[model samples]
Target: MAEPLLDIHGLPGHLIRRLNQIAVAQFMEKMGEIAVDLTPVQYSALCAVKSHPGIDQASIAGLIAYDRATLGKVIDRLEAKGLVSRKVSPQDRRARVVKLTKSGQELLQQVHPVVRAAQGDILTGLDNVEQAQFIALMQKTIQIGNESSRAPQRELGETG
Candidate 1:
């Protein structure tokens, strides 16, 4: 057989990225079961708007760690689905403020249980106590990542 690529199970960052891909794929599968048909990013955008009603596109992009251009496209899709509303920001005519519409709120209410079920499926390897700890550890690690994000960074195998 050919050589394994990069020791598939070796690096923490690689494992984390693999896990993210798995999680998002699982999310898509689970959402399909519920007939929601939402991509993971769309769900995140909805949650962000739910948490910050009347927030602007740039802020939402930052909140979701999405580039503005991509998030604008996401907003366009959401608007088409009637799950989100956008209005020109009164204070900044150049900006668009976003909010979830009633349908969006209802959709969120339906999605929470589905998402929780999906989370359980994602962490089925862990017991309840381990799941809690895993979540806490993930939160801690993600915070650290956010803090270090502003500094110079390199790709996993970059020569620099």
Candidate 2:
């Protein structure tokens, strides 16, 4: 094959996008292997809800660095699947508090190991130490670039 006009192989953004695609594909495949219907975003949202039982939709979006508007649709899907439930927040009725249903909890319990196993596939060629180093470097890069992201992640207790 002829060399491409632009060398995407050397581009961090291109490589990151490709890695993300691989990660998502691997995660979906793992979920499929277990007969679970969950997307990476859905799983992230579910895990966030599990960690923060009364988290609001906006908070979930922030925690997962997902678009808040799109997260509403994701929450709707999870709700339809009986994985999560939303209720009017007592403190702020305008905001909806999300909590995992019993089914959601059980699904997480079953998926945890599968998800862990899928991580290895996502970084297939990397040995354990390399994987750790790669992850750490990626995390550092993400932290540095967070402010530039359309949807920046927010830690708990942070208010925008």
Candidate 3:
């Protein structure tokens, strides 16, 4: 093939962002084929709520690396869809605890295979070992991003 393209192919941030776009596209395509209509993020939040029943929004956001504001919206949508329910927390009345509804559980069961297939499609270019390695590398990169992002000025050798 000719190199008749932009220089982004060699840039990690550019490649990562492009890959995310592609992954979302693939997810949407697969979800459509299955007649499911959950955004990837919403599905993820549902899974988080299922796994951490009675969890608070802040805890779910932390688990998913999602900001509180965005996660709150996601939770709102889930509640609207009746896939999740939030109520005053017994442990902390000031906070709301979220849980999956029975309908949410059923939909999750139905959607699990489709989501798995979407993930498999995204990694079809790699063998099992390569897939595992790729995931490890991505996790490491995210971990570093999280750590450095917290103290960006420290990484830049800047003083407050």
Candidate 4:
């Protein structure tokens, strides 16, 4: 039988949706306070590049849970905006490494405090212990998801 639909008030999916809604709304508001024009996805891409210097475009896409095509467009937009640059990787001529430009670094500096403040606001309800626990649980959940995705496909003659 199919699983029952969850009610909006207390279900896991609903809670996650609500959390995202709140976080995004507050983040935008905080961004306006700091005069940053980038959207959440844009900031995320910028931060990813900043966090993982010398990372390849494909790796950035994987890290951010974005498809290659969509990440390509994002990189294009960032390049157009003078925020990021791509160069042929020294290790692999066929691969392109992505990095933030000076402008992008400056923008990140301007927005980083706002983002930190927003995160602080989000975690305000939780004590340090709870925050740590929450992060641990989230990591565990993601690890489980990764393991399931990497599990071997069943064969016709395979038995478990």
Evaluate residue 34 in candidate 2 and report its C-alpha lDDT on the 0 to 100 scale. 84
Please give the TM-score that candidate 2 achieves against the real structure.
Answer: 0.95
- lDDT ranking from best candidate downward: 2, 1, 3, 4
Model 3 over residues 1-160: C-alpha lDDT tens digits?
8767787778999988888998999988887888887888888888888887888887777766667787899999999999999999988888899999999999999988888866867877899899999999998887677745532212111232
Candidate that would win on TM-score: 2
Model 1, 1-160: lDDT tens per residue? 9777777679888888888889999998888888897888899889989988998887777776666788899999999999999999999999999999999999999997888777877787899999999999988887668635532222222221
lDDT of candidate model 2 versus the reference = 0.92
Query: Over all chains combined, what TM-score does candidate 3 have?
Result: 0.86
Per-model TM-score versus the true fold: 0.83, 0.95, 0.86, 0.76
Q: Which ten residues in a row have the lowest lDDT in candidate 2?
A: 2-11
Candidate 4 worst ten-residue window by lDDT: 151-160
For model 2, residues 1-160, the per-residue Cα lDDT tens digits are 9867677888899998999999998888888888999999999999999999999999999999998999999999999999999999999989999999999999999998889777888888999999999999999999999989999999876766
Worst 10 residues of 1 by lDDT: 151-160
Clashing pairs in 2: none
Give the lDDT of residue 52 in candidate 4: 86
Q: How accurate is candidate 3 locally (lDDT)?
A: 0.81
Model 1 C-alpha lDDT versus the unseen true structure: 0.83
* Candidate 1: segments with Cα more than 4 A from true spot: 1-6, 147-160
